[model samples]
Target chain A: MTLEIETGGVQLSTPILPASGTFGWGTELKNLVDYSALGAVVTKGISLHPRKGNPQPRLLEVPCGLINSIGLQNPGVDAFIQNYEKELSALSMPVIVNIFGESPQEYAEVATKLSNCHWVSGLEINLSCPNVHAGGLEFGSNITGVRDVIQAVRNSTNKPLWAKFSHSTHLFHLVEAALEAGSNAVVLLNTLPALAINIKSKQPVLGARRGGLSGPPLKYVALRDVFDVYSRFKCHIVGVGGIIKPEDAVEFILAGARAVEIGTGAMVHPELFIKCRNFMSEYLKNGSYESVENMVGLAHDDQHV
Target chain B: MRDSPTHFQLTITGNEKVGDRFFLLSFENPGVSFRPGQFAMVAISGEPYPLLRRPFAVSRTPEGTLQILYRVVGTGTRLMSYWKKGRKVNVIFPLGNGFEKIQNACILVGGGSGVASMIALARELHSRGTPYLLCVGTKKSGELDPHSSVFQNPPLNVKFATEDGSFGFHGTVLDLAEQHIHSFTCAAVCGPPAMMTAFLERFPDVNAMFSLENHMGCGTGVCLGCAIETRNGMMRVCVDGPVFPGKILLPEHLK
Candidate 1:
C-alpha cells in the first residue's frame, strides 16, 4: 500500500510525523524511535533568541493527558543550526523546523536563518503556543496577526510553510488569513489551553499557572476541527492532538487530515510512528484503498474531493 | 555505531513486599548495563491507565536480574505492586546522566524512596575498592526492607536513621551524617527536596552531587518536562542528568 503523500508542498514518505516540541530537534530520541518509520522530523519551537522557559513544575499529568508550560525553551535559531544542522542534514528523512518568535519581524528573521540550511525541508510556523505570554496564542487568535506572521515568514523563504494553529473560536478566519498569506498548509489544533490546580498547595500546579493540554482527550476535538476546516476551505490540513493509537490516525485521515503529527502519544509510546505506519499499511490493504491520499476525508458525508 | 538505549518487554521474575508500602520488584535484564545513578522508565505492557511511564532507578541483583525498590506513593507504583511474576513490562533503560565517580572517599545519602538510587552507586564503589558510606533515612523502620540484597552481607559500610526512632540513629539521616561530616571529602545525595536542601546548607564546603526526581512526560529528552533551572541554565533531568552537581542546582531547585 502507498503511504507516501505530499502535504504543504513537501513530499512525505509516510503520513506519520512527530509533532513539534514532542520530537526535540528530531535527533534526541534516535536510540528509542525508529526514524525510518517517520515521514519527517519536526523540531521543537525555536525563537530568535534563547529562552529559559518557565520555572519548575513545568509539566503535570492528568488521567489520560499531560499539561505543559515549557515556554519554548530553546537555544536560539543560530545555536540550533550550529548544533543540529549537520546531524539533521545527515538524516535520510526530511527535517521540518518549528519556528516561533515574539513578533512578525522575529519570525521572519528566524525563517530567513533556517532557510539557509538546505536540510530544512519546511517551516512549521508556531503561532499557537499557549505557554508563552506573547506571539504564540496572541498571533494565532487574531486574523491580522496570523497574516502578518505568515506573510513575514513567506517573504523570508520560498520553502514550504505550515501554519500551526491553536484551538480558537475564530479558527476559520485564522486559517483563511494564513493561507492567503502564503502558508502551504495549516496544522489543525495545537494543544488546547487548560489549567490544573494543586489542591494541597492551594495554587496552580504548573509554574506558568496555565499550559496546553495534549493526549487522548484531544483526539476528538482535533478531528472535529480538521473535518470542519477541510469542509469549509480548500486547504491542506495536518491533523494533530491526542493520537495514541493507530485507529486515531485513521480517524484523523477520515476527518480530512492529509498528514498527522503525533505529539504526547509518541512520548507515551516511542515506537508509535512505526506502529502507526505498520497499522496504516495493513489498514489500506484491507480497506482496498489505493493510497493514504485516497482515504483522506472518506468519512465526510459530502466529501470535498 | 553508537550504542542506543534499549526498549523492551521483559517478564517479572519476582515481586515481594518488603516494607509497609515498599516492594522489591525483579525482572529479567535486557542485557544493557546501566550507570550507578541512571534510571529506567517503566510501564505495564498493555495498560494505559497511568498514560506516561514512571521513572525508577535501576539496580542489578546478585543473580544478574534487574530490580527497582519502589514505594506505593501514587497510582503508578500502586499498579506496579499488582504485577505478578511472568508479567511483561515495557521498559526503557540506562537513561540520563549518572553520578560521576569520585576518586576520594564519598558519603552517599538517601532518604525514603530516594535510597533506591544509592544502592547501585554503593555497589559500584564497593567493587572499585572505593571507601564510601551509605546513609539511608526514612520515616520509620517499617519503611525499609532490611533483608533485601541492598542491606545483605556486602563488605560495604551502611548506616540508617529513622524519624520515628525505631531504626539505627534516632533522628534524621542528616543527623547521623553530622558525626561523619568531615570524614568524607565529597558526597552524593538523592532524596526529598528538603533533605537535599539541608545537605547543601549544612555541608556547603563539601563537593556534592544530587539525584533529582521530577514529573516526567518522556524519560527521554524530548518532552522537556523535567527541565530544572540551574546555575548554568535550564537542564533537563532526563538527558542532562538525573544526577547533577550540587553547586549547579539553584536554591529554588532545592525547594
Candidate 2:
C-alpha cells in the first residue's frame, strides 16, 4: 500500500503529476478540480522573458489527438516569479516549473532565476519542443544537444532535474544521456512530431505547419517509451503523452512509470487531475493492490501477482 | 488565461426563423450570468469536426436564460445549431472581458448574428434602467424574431430595409438611425464588418461600441489569435475587450 514518491525535498502521495502547458496555470481550471489532489502541478513552460509565441493556427485537432505549437508561450521567469510564484508558494504540492530556452545559456539563466525561489520544487528542462525549425535542427531530436542543455541547466539549479524527452529519438540513449548529465528523473515522452493539412485551403492547417501530437492516439507510443526506458535505466520515470482515461493511467503506472503526467488530456477535461486521483484509487482497490507501489511495473513482473 | 472546463445544460425555445442558416436559442441556466457584451463558448453535443468550443455572443438575456442567435458559418457552428433537447452538450461560457459602458444612455444596433450581442446589451441597459434605443437592421421585417422587447411596442420598432422594398425604409439601418442618432448619448453595434464600419462612422459624436466575432483558439487569452489594433496598440480581443469603442479602434482595424 505504500505509494510514496518522496525525494529531493519533494513528497507525493502518488507519482502522477499533470504535465506542463496542458493544465494551463492551476488557477484557470481551479473550479474544476481541487489543486491539492494531484501529486504536483507542473506549471506551463516559461522562458527567461515573456514570449508572445507563433501566429494563428496554434492548435489543430487530429484523430483522437491534437497538434499544438504553442511555442512555450509563457510570461517568462521574472513574471512567473512576480505573479505565479507567490501564489504557488501557498500550494501543498510541489510546483514543478517546466522551462524552455533558445540556447543552453538561456536554459541555465531560467533555472538560475528560479533556483532560489522556494516554490519551484523541481526543474523540467523542456528539451522536446517541436514547433520551431531552429539551426536546421531541433534540440529535442538531438541527443548531444539534449545532454549539453541538461548539463548546463543541472549545474545552474539545485532542484531535481527532469528531462522531457521527445519521441523523435531513441529511449534508452535519451534516458541514459539525461542521467549522465545529472538529471534526477526523466519524463519518458513529449509529443510525436506530426503535420495536419486542411484539404479545402490546400495549405497546412497549423500555422507552425508542424506540431507535437498528444492524446489517446499517443498513449501506446508513450507507454512503449516508459516501458523501454524503465527497463534500461535506474532513474525515476515520469510517464507522459496521450493519457486520456484512468485505465490508461493504470497502463502507464504498470509500464514502470513511477508517476504519469496528463498532457493534452486535461485540455479536454480539466477535472481529470482529480478524476485520475479518484479513478486510480478505485482501480487499485479493485485490483487488490493496496497501493500504487504494488501496481508499478506489475505488467512486466513475471509473477503477475 | 483561466479555463474553467465546466459545461452548462439548458434547453429552451430560441424563436428560430429563416433557413438552417440561423436560429435564436434561448436558455435560462445559472450559467447565463455573463457580462452584457461577453460571449459563451459552445460545442455541439456530438460531432467529429471543429472539436474546439466556438465563441458566440449572448444575443439576449431575458431572465432565466441567455440567447445566442447564431448563423452556421463553419463546421463548428453548423453542428451547434442542430443540437436537440435532452442532449448533454459541453459548453464553457461567459468567457472573455466585455465592453465598458459608462452606465448611461446608449443606442443598440445589430445585423446578422451580431444581433445576438446587441440584444444582450439591450437586456443589460434595460435592467440598469439605462436609457437606450435598440435598432435591428434586417433584410425583411418578419424574418427576425422581434430581437427585443425593450421598447413598449410589441415588435419594439423592429425595422428592415430590403433593396426590393420587402422591408422597412427600403435602405440600410443607418438610414433609420439618422433620424434618431442625436436622441441617444452612446451607441453599441454588432454585425458584419461592413455595417459596423458604417455604424461607427455615422455616430461619430456619440460613443459607438462594436462587438467583433472572429475565430478564436483556446477561447482564452493564451492563443493571441484574436487581436485587434487600436490607438493603444495590439490588444487581445479574447482578453481585453470584445466590445471596443470606435474612438479607441484604428481606422484599418475595422477592415
Candidate 3:
C-alpha cells in the first residue's frame, strides 16, 4: 500500500505532516522525530517583522485540550531564512512555510521573499490564527478578507498555496472564497476560538486574554468541517485540529482529508508522525485499500439514507 | 555542535514521598548525562488528562539512576505523586541550557523546588575542588528532605533558611545570604519568583545567575510558551536558557 499522496501540487511521501506553530522551522526536532515518516514540515507562523508574542501564561491545559495564545511570536521572514534556510533546504522532505502578516500588503511581501527560496515547497497562508490582534482570524472572517489576502499572496508567488481557515459560522463560504482567489488547497479548521478565566484573579488566564483551543476536543469539529468542505467543493483538504492517535488520522482521512497535520499531539508525542504513518499503512493493507488516495472520504460512502 | 535531546521511555524504579509536598522520583539512567541546571519534559506513559508534560530539573543519584525532585502543586504533580515503581514514563531529556561555571568561589541559593536545580552544580563544584556554599530555604522544615540525594554526601558547605524559622536561619533565603555576602564573589539562584526578584534587587553588584521556571509546552524551543524578555530582547526559557546571567535579566521580567 502506497502512502504517497499529493496535496496542493506538492507530493508527500506520507499523509502525515506537522501542523504549523507546533513544529519550529522543521529542524528543532530533527534528532527526536523520524522525518521520513512525514509528508512535509509546516513551519511556525512567520510575519514580515519579528513579533514578541504574548506576555506570560501563554498556554493553559484543559481537559483533553490546550488553549494557546502565542501571538505569532516569530523571528520575522528575513531572519527565519537567515537562521533556518540552509538547514531547511537540506532536509530530505518538503518544507511548507506558514506565513502571517498584519495586512494584505505585508502578507504579499512576505510571500514574495519566500518565493525566492527554491527549497520552499509551498506557502501555507495563515488566515486563521486566533491569538493575534490583527491579520489572523480577522483576515479569514469573511469572503472579502479571505479573497484579498489569498489573491494578494497568489499574485506574489507561484508556489502552492494552502489557505488555513478557522471554524466560523460561514466556514464553507470562506473555503470557496480562498479557492476562488487561487488557493490550491484549504486546511480545514485552524483552532476553535476559546477563552479561559482564572476565578481567583477574576481575569482571563492567557496573556492575550483569549486563545485557540486544540487537542482531542477539537477532533470531531475538525472532522465535520473536512467532511462538509470535501462534499461541497473540489479543493484539496488538509485536516488539522486535535489529532492525538493513529486512529484519529484515519478518521480524518475517511472524513475527506487528503492529508492531516499533527499539532498539539506531536508536541506531546514526538513519534506520532511515524506512528500514524505505520498505522495508516497497516490499515490500508488490512482493508485491501490500494493507497491513501482511495481512503479519502470513505466514510461518506457508508452514510445511511 | 550541541547534542540534540533524545525522546525515550523509562520505567520508574522509585517514587517516594520526601516531605509534605515533595517527592523523590527515580528511574534507570539512560546513560545521558546533563549539565548542571538542565531539565527534562516528563509525563506518565498512558495517562491523558493532563495533556502536556511537566518540565523538571534532572539529577542523577549515587546509585546510578536518574531522578527529578518535584513538589505536588497541581493536577499534573498530584498525578505524578501517585506514580508507582515499574510504571513507564515518557521523557525528553538534556533539554535547555545549563548554568555556566564561574571561576571564583560562589554562593548557591535555592528555595522550594528550586533547590533541585542547584544539586548538580554543587556536585560539579565539589568535584572541581572549588569552594562553594549551598544555601537552601523552605517555608518550614517539613518541606525539605534532608536525606534526599540532592543534599547527600558531597557539597559539604551548606546552610538552611526557613520562613517559619523551623530551620537554621530565620527570614528568607536572601536575608541569610546577605550575612555571607562578603565571602563569595558570585551567586547562583533558583526558586520562587519573589525570592529570585529579591536576589536581583538586593545584590545588584554581586555577579549572579538565575535559573528561571515557567509553564512550558514543549521543552524544545518550538512552543515559545516560556519566553521571557531580557536585555537581548525576547528569549525562550527552554532554549536560550532555563539559566540566564543575573545582569541581563530585566527587573520587570521576574515579576
Candidate 4:
C-alpha cells in the first residue's frame, strides 16, 4: 500500500501534492484539510518582498475552468519563514517552497535564503507563471532565461530543484535546459494563457486583462505536453494543469509524470486529496500493479516512444 | 456536518422568482449545520462552460432543505434560472465565518438581497427568545412580501422601506432604522455596499455587524481572489470574513 515517490532525493508519502497558489501559505487550509497526510505542501508563489497582487476582479470563471491573475500575491520570503516556518515545519510531509523572481539573481537570493531553512523539502522554481507582468512569462518562455534562472537557483540551494514551466512551443527545450542546469525534476504545464471578455461591457473579465486557464479543460493539453517531454527524457516530470479526479492523476502518471499537482480541483473540494489517494490506492490494488511508480510511463510503450 | 466544507450532490427542490432579477433556490440539505451569513459555493450546471461555482448566502435552513437567495447578475446566475427542479448540482457548503452572537434588543437591518442572510439569524434569535426587530428595504414596493410565510408565520415585527414611497416607509432601510435606533443598543446589517456604508456613516457609535460581499473564486481561502479592503489592509472575504465589525469597515468606506 506504499505510495511513495523519490523525486530528486525527496521521499514523498504520496504522489499527490497541492499546486502552488491554490494551496495558499499552508495555514489557510489548516482547518479545511489535513496537510500532514499529503505528499507535500507547495505554497503560493513567494518573492523577496510582499506583493499587493492585481487590482479587483483578479479572477473569472470560464467554461470548465478558472482564469486568475493574482499577480503572485505573497508575504515575501522573510515573512514566510518568520510567520509560517513553525507551522510548515510541524507538518509531517515535505514543504516544497514555490518561489518566483524578477531576475535570476533575485531567484538565487530567495533560494539561497530558503536553503538554510530546515523545514523546506525542496524548491519549485516558477519559470512560467503567466499572471505577473515581469519575471514569470519572460523567463519561462525563453530557453536561455529558463536555464539561467534554474542554474542560478540551482547553485544557491542543494535542495531538489523542480523547474515548473508552462505549455509553450519551446517547453521541451526549456525542460532539457532545466535538466542541464541541474534541475532534479521539471513540472509541466502551468496554466494556458487565456482571456475572456464581457461583451456587454466591452471589457476583459479579469483584472489583468489576461490570465492563466486552469481546470478540467487543461488536462489533455497538459497530458500531451507531459507525454511529449517524457518520451524523450528519462528525467522526473511533475504534471499539473487541470487534475480533478483520481483518474486524472492516473492519466498523468501513465503519461510519464512521477507525481501530479492538484490546483483548482483542490480548491473546489478540499477533501480531494484524500479522495484521490483512496481512488489511486484502490485502482493500484485492483489492477494488481506493484506500485504507482510502476505505472509511470506505461502508456509510452514502443509505439509512443 | 463535517469539520471542513464537504462537497454534496444537492437536488434542486424549488426555484422561486421572489423579485425582479432575484430567485430563491431551495435544495435538499445534507444535514450540514451552518450558521447564518455562512455561504455555499453552488455549481450552476454540471457543464464545464460555467466552471466555477457561484457563491450564495444560505438564505434559510428549514427542515431538510437549504435556501439561497441569488440575483441574476452575470452569466453563471443567468444560466442557473434555466435549470429545472430535481436537477442535481454540486455544492460545497458551510464556507466562511458566520455572524457572531448578537446582544439582546439589537435591530437587524437588511436591504435588497442582503435580507436573505438575515432570515436565518432572525430565526435563530427568535428561538432564543431574544427581542429583535427586522427592517427590510428594497427598490420598489413588492421586492418581498412582508406578509409571506417567511415573515408572517412567526409574526415577527417587520418594517419595510421603498425608494418609490409605495411601501410602508418612504426612504431607505437606514432611514427607516433611524426611529428605532435609540431603542436598541446594537445592530446587525447586510445589504448593498452603499446602503451598508450609509448605515455606518449615520450610526457611527452603534456597534453593528455587517456581512460584506465581494466577487469570490473558491469561496474557500485558497483562491484569495475575494479581497476586502479593511483597516488592517486587504483581507480575504472568503476567510478573514464575509462578516466584520462595523467599526473596521467604516474607516475605509467613510473615508
Candidate 5:
C-alpha cells in the first residue's frame, strides 16, 4: 500500500537524503532539521584526521548552483566517531557515515573504528575529494586505487558499503571497479570541476585553482548519469544534481533513482530538505502512487513492480 | 559562519541613483543586524552573466530595511534592473567585518555608491549619539535619495559635492576634505578607488579605514580567494576584511 524501498538491508521512510559536505555534524542545523524525519542523513564527508581543509574563498555561487572546494574539512574519523557516534545512535533514521582517506589503510582504519559503533548504518567510501592535491580525484579515477579502497574498506567493516563515483566520461569504469570490489551501492557524480574570477581584483575566485560545481546547473547532467548507469546496470541508483523543487525530486525517482541527494539547493536553502520532504509527501498523496517504491523508476513506462 | 539559502526580497527597482547600478539587499528578519562598512554578495538569482555575486557597500539602514549602492556594469546589473517588486535574490551577507567604531567626532567621506556604506555608519553614530560629519559627492544631489522622504532626522552634518557643479561644491571629495582632515578623530571612506586613495593620501594622519571589494568564494575566511595586499602581508578580504585601516595597506595597492 506504501512506497517502501529497501537499501543496504534497511527501509527508507522517504527517498531524499542530504548529500555529504552540505550537511554538517547534524547539530549545526539542529534548529532546522529533525533527524527522525529524513529518509536518511548523510554526514559531512569525514576524513582520517582533523583537516583545516582549504583556505578562504571555497564557495562560488553560480546562477542556480554553487561551486565549492571545502577540501573535505572534518575532524578525522577517530574524532568523528568519538563525537558523533553517540548523537547518531539517538537518531531514529538510518545514519550514513561518509568516510574519506588518503590511503587504503587510513580508509580501513576509520571504517574499523566506525564498525564497532552500533549507530552507524553504512559507509559511503569517498573516492573523490576534489580539493586536496594528493590522492584526491586521482584515487577515484585509477582502477587499482578505486578497487583497492573499496576492497580494503569492505574487508575491514561489516557495515554496508556505498562507493561514491565522480561524474566524468569514464564513470562506467569507476562503477565497474566499485562493483568488482563488492560495494552495496554507488553514489554517482561528485561536483564537476569549476572556478570563478574577480575582474576587479584580477584573480581567480577560489583559492584552489579548481572546485566541484553543484546545484540546478547540473540537474540534467546528474540525471543523464543516473540514466546512463541505470540503463546499463540495474544496481541501486542514488540520484544527485540540481534538485531544488519537489518536481525535481519526482524526476529523479522516475529516472530509476531509488533515492536522490540535494546538494547545491541546500546551500541556497538550508531548510530545503525539510521543505522538499513535505512537498514530496503531497506529490505522493495527490497521485495514484501509493508509496515511494512505486515511483522509483516510473519514467520507463510499462515497468512497475 | 553558518550558511543558509535564505534570501532577501529587496525593492530595488525605484532606487537607482546617479552611480547606483546595484541595490544592496538585506533580510527584513527582525533578528538580522549589520553594521557600517559591511557588504553583501548579491546575484540576480537567475542572471546569466556574473553568474556569481558582486560586492556592494551597505549604503543605509532604513527603519526596518537595509540598503547598498552599486553601479550597473555587466550582465548581472542589466538583469538585476529587471527585478520585480517581490523579486528575492540569493545573497551571502554581513560578510567580512565592518569598519572600527568611531569615537570622538568622526568624519565620513563617500564617493558615489561608495557613499552607500557610510550611511549605515552615519545611522550607527546617530544611535550612539556620536557627533559626525558626512561629506558626500556625486554628479547631482538628486540621486542622493530616491527615498529622501525618510531622512528628515539625519545622523550627521551632511554636505554634498558635484562634478559639473550640478548641486554642491565643484570639486572631488579629497579636495573638499583637505582643509578638515585633522578636525575629526577618525575617518571612514568607501568610494571609487581613485577617490578613496585621494582621501587616504589627504588624511595620512587620521585613522582611516577602507573596505575593499574582492571576488570571494565564501564570505567566511576559510577560502583565501579574496586576497588583498596589505603592508603587514596578504590576507583574504572575505575573512580578513571587506574593511581595513589606511596604514595596513600600501599606496600601490590602489594603483
Candidate 6:
C-alpha cells in the first residue's frame, strides 16, 4: 500500500520515521535499516553551543518506561553542518533537522544556517525537550512562548516548519499557537516529565534528578493529546511515543496522526524500522485499506468502519 | 571496520558458579568468531526495570561453549545471576575493538574479576600457538578456589597472588609481575584501575594492551555514555577500544 504523506511540502514515501536523538545523526544506523523505505530521518537536537550533557546515571529504567535526562547534548549547529552534512546529503531520503536553542533568536539562528544547506528537507523546532534545565520545555509549556519561537524560526527560513510540542497541560494551546505562527505540522508529544528513585541509596536515579519518560507508559497520553489536538484543529500530526508495534502506529493514525515516529522502540530493537514496515504492509492489505492515508482519522468518524 | 552486528536471542545453556560472587553463564554459540577482548551487550530483563543492556566480555570454554564471566556487582548483574537454563536473553555481539596479535612472548595479568576476560585470551593464544604467561590475582585464596572449572587444565604457565598470603604470591598481581617484567616482550593487563595504573608505571616503555570497563547504554557509538578521555581525544569505550594500548589510556591520577 502507498504510505506516501505530504507534510510541509515534502513528500514522504512512507509514514515511518525514527525520532530525533534515538536515531543519532542517521549515519550510525545506515547499515542497519533500509533508509529508502523510510519517510525521513530526524536528527538529535542541535543547539547554538556544544553541550557536555548530564553526568553518569543519566538513564534509569522504570516499570514500563525509560527515564532519561541526557540534557540535549550535541556538537552545536556549525560542527553538525561541517561534519554530518556530507553524510546526511547521501542518505537519499528526507532529512529533518531538529533544532533547539536557549531563546527564540538562537532557534532562528540555527534555522537560518540550516536553510543555506541543500541537504535538509525540513526543520523540526525542538521547543519541548523536557530533560534540559532551560529553553526547551519552558518554551513549549505556554502558548505565547510557543508562538514566539515558531514565529522567529518561520521568519528565518522558508523550509518546512514542524513545531515539536510536549505533553504538557497547555499542549493544546501551544499547538494552536504553532499553527498561528505558520507551522506546517506539529510533532505531537515529546517525552513526559517524570522522576524515579533508588530506595537503597535514597537518591534520584537520573543524574539530573528528574527526566522525561518514554515507551509504553507514554503511549496513551500521546494518543490522547494527538486526538484532542486533531479533533479540534484538523492539523497534520507526527505522532510519537511508544510506537513499538504496527498496531500502535495504527492506533496513532486512527487517532488522527498522519505519520508516526519511533523512539524508544528503535533503541530496544534496531531492526524496528523494517519490522514496522512489514507489519504495516500486511495490516493495510488485510484491512482492505487502499493506503495508509485511508486509515487516518478512522476513529474520529461516526461509524466504526 | 567489521560488519554491523546482529541482535539475536540466545538461550542460556547454564549459569554455573565459577568463583566467589562470580558466575560463568554459557549460551548457545551463534557460530560467530570474536576476538579475545570483544564484548556483548546482554539484556538483564525484557521489561523496562533495567532498561539498558549490560556489557560483558566474551569468553568461551574448552568445550566450545560461548560464555560470559560476570560478577554480581549491581542490580543488572544480580538479575543475570538468577537466569536459568533454557531462558533466552537478547544480546548484540562482537562489539568494540579487541586486542591485536602478540608477536613475542606475552604476559597476561588479570586482577580480581578481570581474570574472566583473561580466560578467553588464554584460550585463543593457546590455540594459535602463541607463548604467554597467565597471572590471576584476587583478594584471597578462597576467591580463586580449586573447585572452579576456570582453573582446570590451563595450557600455559599459571601464577597466582593474594593479599593475605594464602596463594602463590603474598601481594598484589603487579608486585608479582615485577620479577618477570624483563623476561616477556609484551604484556596484556585487565583489572581494576589501580592495578592497571601501577602496572603502567612499573613498565613505562613496555608494550601492553589493556581491557577497560565502563557503564554503557547502547554498546554502540550512539548513546555516547561510555566515552573515555584518551591521550588523543574523547574516545568511546564501547566502539573505539575497550581494548586500548597502554600509551593511549590516560593515567588514572591525571584523570
What's each prediction's clash count?
Answer: 0, 6, 0, 2, 19, 0
The CAPRI category of model 2 is: acceptable
Q: Which portions of model 4 miss their true places by more than 4 Å?
A: A30-37, A129-137, A303-305, B1-17, B20-34, B43-49, B59-66, B74-91, B200-205, B250-255
TM-score of chain A of each: 0.96, 0.92, 0.96, 0.95, 0.92, 0.94
Q: Is candidate 1 or candidate 6 better by TM-score?
A: 1
Put down candidate 4 lDDT per residue, B1-255, tens digits, no spaces: 324677788899988776677777888767787778888888765545676777888855435467887778888889887777998888887888888777678799998878877877887777677888889898888778666556643567788999899989999889899989888888888888788888877998998998877777788787778875577776788878888888777444422
DockQ, cand. 1? 0.78
True C-alpha contacts between chains kept, each model in order: 0.81, 0.09, 0.78, 0.59, 0.14, 0.23
DockQ of all candidates, in order?
A: 0.78, 0.26, 0.78, 0.51, 0.15, 0.38
Off by over 4 Å in 1: A129-137, B1-3, B153-156
Query: Model 2, which residues run further than 4 Å from truth?
Result: A1-4, A7-9, A129-136, A198-202, A301-305, B1-7, B11-19, B46-50, B59-63, B109-111, B126-184, B191-206, B210-236, B244-255
Per-residue lDDT, model 6, residue A128, is: 69
Task: In angstroms, give how far residue B23 of model 5 lies from its true place.
Answer: 5.2
Tell me the interface RMSD of model 6, in angstroms.
Answer: 2.8
How far residue A195's Cα lies from its native spot in candidate 5, in Å, is 5.9
Clash pairs detected, candidate 2: B14-B24, B27-B65, B28-B64, B28-B65, B59-B116, B160-B168
> What does candidate 5's lDDT look like per residue over A1-305, in tens digits?
45456765556777778877666664445543554447887887777777766655666667666777767767688888788777778887888888988788888888998889888888888887432445345678778778888999989988888888777777888788888888888887677878788999888877665788877778788888887777667678788887876678888877878888876565445456767777777778888677777776667644654
Report the CAPRI category for model 4: medium
Candidate 3: list runs displaced more than 4 Å: A129-137, A302-305, B1-3, B153-156
Question: Cα deviation in Å at residue B122, candidate 5?
Answer: 1.8
Residues A48-141 of candidate 4 have per-residue lDDT tens digits of: 8888787667887776888888878888899989999888898888999999988888899999999999999999999864324453456888
Q: Of the candidates numbered 3 and 5, which has the greater TM-score value?
A: 3
lDDT value, candidate 2, whole model? 0.70
Query: Distance (Å) between predicted and true CA of A223, model 3?
Result: 0.4
RMSD of each: 2.1, 4.3, 2.1, 3.3, 6.0, 3.4
Could you give candidate 3's per-residue lDDT for residues B1-255 as a string of tens digits? 334699878889999888889898888888886788899999744545788989999876556678888999898999899999998888998899997766789899999889878877887787787879999899888787676655774535778899999978998889899999789988999998888988888999998999999988888988888888899999999989999999899877775
